[model samples]
Target: MSKPKDYTLLVIDDELQVRRFTEVSLSPHGYEVHSAESGREGIELGTKLNPDAIILDLGLPDMDGLDVLSSLKSWYQGPIIVLSVRDDEDSIVAALDSGAHDYIRKPFHLGELLARLRLALRNNQANQTSPVYTSGNLSVDLSSRRVTVGEREIKLTVTEFELLKVLIRHRGKVLTHNQILTEVWGPKSVEHIQYLRVYVGHLRQKLEADINKPRLILTEPGVGYRLQNLDLLKEGMTASEAALIAEKVD
Candidate 1:
């Protein structure tokens, strides 16, 4: 009849307000929270604390978030959710490709943030034994952590890769916006559905033959999305994206 114990988390953000707010926010959830003001300090603390997960701000006072991300990837082996206000495609792609487990845009809800954090922890543990994930034309070799589209390698940002993997793992099921957000983003953020729209837009743009009539990334209107069967592609000529890709054919 006792309350469940809280997990440990390391939060790395240069902004004092953000750091303090996050620490207080997570404290009630039974999480043993640690704070760092710099990427360097974060990495060192991450090694020492061995926390369940890490929340890292991309823009740091001492170093770039991406640079710190690279450093963290070099040593740490846990869930890392990249925090940033930058919503551009290039920045999101760069962070995910570098090894961030997930990403969070700033000005978010505390409850959603906690959800995202916990989901990251759960996924990190799940990936330890078996890493390969499959859905439609996409197959992610988790052990090798590689993603391929019909035998052709498709580069995905870390967050993209995670999103694809989760969607694949739960194919055919109707994952609500919040469900996808929680699963892909983390336990900390189950309600930031806008983030889902942006990331899903990116995934379809990258993976579908045609982004307009997305065959691979199927939308559920007001709900979440899904991966269509691979056969759907060969049977259809809808390649809005193929034309988009063709632009680079030269």
Candidate 2:
């Protein structure tokens, strides 16, 4: 296992206390923490450091957090988690749509923040390293275009598979409806959110053990959907090993 020091985290927040708290809390866990007070400075530091992950606040001094997120997403491919006091659903949806990997309301627990950070980093690495994704009883083999739920092979339509590919690629992260539509159907189809819903329902019926209560593909209320990241199966095996086993199984 790689140590946290192998990762560098950038925190973009105007609040001095938030910066200090994040630095003090994460530094001991082997992470290299850096802070920027304004959106411009954050963008500059982000470019200079090219950190593995970023903890961004929606309220920046020079510009709106959404604008900063837009700028970063244009160049940065790493995970960016929005940490802010904005609790409104609109703000959350906007952030997710703007390319945030996750959203955490203010007055958050350090443990939860750490867990989110870990997940974001893990998912990012997994996307780069593996063509297969597994969670719970579900396994998707992107290389072969195969999906299985336990012992049963599940067949999916081309559109359904494309949608599932998007979700699996960003497993554990919230994907806005617009993002999903744009990726799956195209930018012109972004407004067709109902199309996304129907396909998701089809996926649930095929993937979920109980369509009434989905454990894999989860709805993020008014935002979008997230693939639950249950990760590797069994003890002591890495995700790669599990993927290999899943691909080999009948």
Candidate 3:
């Protein structure tokens, strides 16, 4: 589907005042805002309309916020930032685990929420599928959702695409299992390290010349994973010598 000219947002919260306030805050910034008074309505809107981002409140009349987040994650690729009055550790952790990209407790400054939205948009640019970059033999198009490795287009699942995006975002930064899990799968996913291992292995099989000992997606044993183009990091090269690596993901 062709993306709309403006960034579109879906705000899901049972509180009328909160939903209205968020809509007011975001609309002026050139975002097309949509609102839902309950979790069920929000889910329907999210599934039917491919909005650029979502702002969901955990305490909904129809369902728990974490459940809403998890259900949406199976289908959406764009960011979903959670808003709620509950700030308990478990609640926060669950929201993240359910696939929320970011969170803000109730009584948050509208400005701060706006800033977080901007960051999510900045990050979503990678998922745009535009013809973006090439490293070695891989060609990535963020805007078109097309990838070509050695002149052949590669097919990837939603989860695989998202996994690839997370690795590319931290290109040189060695992302620990927990950090990667939270960022890619949500905070509640800290214990699912095996899921990470399996997907990383899949990525290696698809991208590496030899899957047994990978090159592009480097594993750090007990630490985490670092993804970098090996040619850009030959011996004696400074970290600064690493080329600006890029990947198209959403």
Quick one: best lDDT, which candidate? 2
TM-score order, best first, reads: 2, 3, 1
Put down candidate 1 lDDT per residue, 1-250, tens digits, no spaces: 8466568888999889998998787788778889999989998898888888889898888889899889888988877787788877567656765767666678766655665565456545545545565546677786677878787998889898889877765533234566678777787887688888899889888777778877666665444564544532233323543333222111
lDDT by candidate, in order shown:
0.70, 0.86, 0.72
Task: Give the per-residue lDDT of model 3 (tens digit) for 1-250.
Answer: 6344478899999998997887777777778889999889999999988799999999898898888898899989888988889877667656654657766678877665665566566545633543465556876666676777897888888888788877766444345677788888898998999999999988877888889766678765454676654433443233332321111110
**Model 3, TM vs. native:** 0.55
Query: In model 3, which regions exceed 4 Å deviation?
Result: 1-5, 127-250
Q: Where does candidate 1 have its weakest 10-residue lDDT segment?
A: 241-250
Candidate 3 versus truth, CA RMSD in Å, comes to 11.0
RMSD of 1: 14.1
For candidate 3, the per-residue lDDT at 117 reads: 67
Indicate which candidate wins on TM-score: 2
Q: Quick one: ranking by lDDT, best first?
A: 2, 3, 1
